[model samples]
Target: MPVSSATSTAESPPAAVPSATVPHSWEYDGTEPFPEKEPAAPRDRGERLYVAVTAAIVLAPFLALGLAGWLLWGRLIHPADIVLALVLYTVTGLGVTVGFHRGLTHGGYRAVRPVRIALAVAGSMSFQGDVIGWVATHRRHHAFTDRPGDPHSPYRYGTHLRGQLRGLLHAHVGWLFRNSRTSAARYAPDLLADRDIRAVSRAFPALCLLTLALPFGLGWAIGGTLVHALTALLWAGLVRIALLHHVTWSVNSLCHVIGDRPFRTRRHDRATNLWPLALLSFGESWHNLHHADPTSARHGVDRGQLDPSAAVIGLLERLGWVSDVRWPTPDRVAARRV
Candidate 1:
């Protein structure tokens, strides 16, 4: 969310105050009153359908290519493939978890100039849209939560099985296809004002190309074969994106519908922690704590819960690159107990 500011004046004597007595009148005002919130625009059903169809078409070829690569070159799990997968996973996953979600979305901690730029670039390479767009959508997600204005609420279609299935698909990827985009002015004004962020967001298409090309380039450099490059691209590029997309989307879908809600939230805000997604989502599956304390740097505040993203933020703090970290205190967590 964008930072807010307030203006206040010390108490002053009223114009008609008695000469022998002091009078007090104080006034304060917050940043220019936010514009009245406009109702969300109506979604164009034809456009929505077109976007969904086009996404299927674009994504279908990649799925076929992945399957072919797996059949032809995935017979033996090469050590190189494993290493590359782990490396790419860490880089890209952290780029989203620590960089996009924590650093940018919540301002969990302050990052130095270099780290901030690098994080934005790395997150862009994840192909999850530009920093400003991502942050804007996320802020909206938190603001409206599971309500009508939420961009990807699983409950938008009701609890019936078929409705849920449709909602799941919508939350997972369908939301991206629609023509409607979040308003950055309302959600991410701070980022919009930054020239560097705008430049990075504008370079998103180029960064996406690099994401696919880098893995292939590395594969050929290491394995010295076109087949190796193809396999790496499948595993590290397409499959990885599909997996991350699902995991992140689950926070919007499954996380809100299933798992253990150990912490309390506002009515209708049903976020939960699903252990199965821990490692895959870089500890983001600890959704219960996340919603309970949205600004807390650590989502996995409970014992034995693994949160690599929080760990990285802690490390950055120690390095003095980030300050004002919002680590959750025991009292804060306890107050939100379900």
Candidate 2:
């Protein structure tokens, strides 16, 4: 007898299902073929609350110190405190200006091993994170300037006065609290490659403690009193850091928002020359010149600009500590004029 077409088709053992298209038998069994993955959710409000709380922890104490200093009738800060503050301020400021900014960021000058390590340590004592992190953020700042991804730009908010004021605050201190960290891999490859720098970066927290404690220790030795030590710690450590932070932030905020733009830069980049802050900011107030010629070791190119940082670099060069310094040429400066 001839087999019926329908029965023959049905009896063909399901036509030997193709391996590629067939569902795995394990999928239907007790075990799952693929592991289930939990979906990533947005960060909770509690995390944001923690960040705000931590920021207050860092900022509130300094604000109180400033207020107390202002309120106190007698000398809240003595001469010893002032001197110590000035000395440390100058050391750390030079470390950032010369070592981190010029040397690390732009390679404006080369230094010997000892000089490099010393500078990295000095900068670490400033409590501005590791040297690599500082250089990375700063380089990103220059690379993006006032653009969307700029770490701290006064223009990020808007041109309106209120917006600018908010932006100034953000640029000054708020950016530090941000969780979006700069990638050192992309921005600071050179520093990352240096073992000395990596080691110093790892030791940043200890150096910061020493920076604060050294003032108190010195004051105690000099004045032979705990009161003097406290005063010195407040003024030399806390107040000095606060002041430097603002000055540096001002270069990002006020320097971009206001001041004389004598030198031309890329369009919308309003880097300016605020001469009043030259000494206080260790010559960093010459923002226009810096933006114009970033590789030049001296930002205050004009006569009588009073760049103490530049003077320090010059002294270092004369002492054979820093070599191949990139001082600006007259032609280069002229070419940058508006």
Worst 10 residues of 2 by lDDT: 1-10
Candidate 1 per-residue lDDT over residues 7-44, each given as its tens digit = 00001111232233322342211111112134646657
**Model 1: lDDT of residue 49:** 77
Best candidate per lDDT, number? 2
What is candidate 2's CA lDDT for residue 159?
A: 65
* Residue-wise C-alpha lDDT for candidate 2, range 84-138, written one tens digit per residue: 9899999988888877777777777788889988988998887777898888788
In terms of TM-score, how similar is model 1 to the real structure?
0.82
**Global lDDT for candidate 1?**
0.73
Clash pairs (backbone) in predicted model 1: none
